[model samples]
Target: MTTQTSTQAQVIPKFGEQKKAFSIDKLKRLVNAAKSMSDFDQAKRYLCSYFIPCSNPHGVFMWRSEIKNLEHILDKNISKLICSITKVFYT
Candidate 1:
């Protein structure tokens, strides 16, 4: 009896060819939409500034726990804001 083994080749994706797991523009739009919510100016500003492309003197600093609190005021869907910010900043 003879046994044969088959080998498969692995393919690596190039930088440009790699598919993005998330979209920055989409996240920015979502943040902007969240900013439009009424009665949460401070939270809005904090969240918006987090997305600023230019140098931020104020700095981008937010506690993970704080995100939980802000999510209540900003969005009904908890994961929307959290996931976007986490993916953009943490990753």
Candidate 2:
């Protein structure tokens, strides 16, 4: 005679919706304003203060890659703004 064993796994419940701490509208406005700036110094100041760093390197790399890939999609003015922002924040 032969005997067989079986195992069962436990399931976890999914969490509910999360609330954001910052104001999306305000952030959008701020970013839009920064994008419109003609001076690099002004744009750099705004981005350095407003954009926070992520803990993960992979995420950051992906974000940079995405930005590069989408560069053509953004307006020329916005691209200059982003370049200044990146120079300030990444450095």
RMSD of each: 19.1, 20.8
TM-score of each: 0.19, 0.22
- lDDT of each prediction vs. the true structure? 0.33, 0.29
Q: Candidate 1 lDDT, tens digit per residue, 1-91?
A: 2111110122323222323332446445444443234423433444443332223333223223333221112224335544644212221
Off by over 4 Å in 2: 1-20, 33-35, 39-51, 54-57, 60-91
Sliding window of 10 residues with minimal summed lDDT for model 1: 1-10
Global CA lDDT computed for model 1:
0.33
**Model 2 scores what on Cα lDDT?**
0.29
Best by lDDT: 1
Q: How many backbone clashes can be found in candidate 1?
A: 0
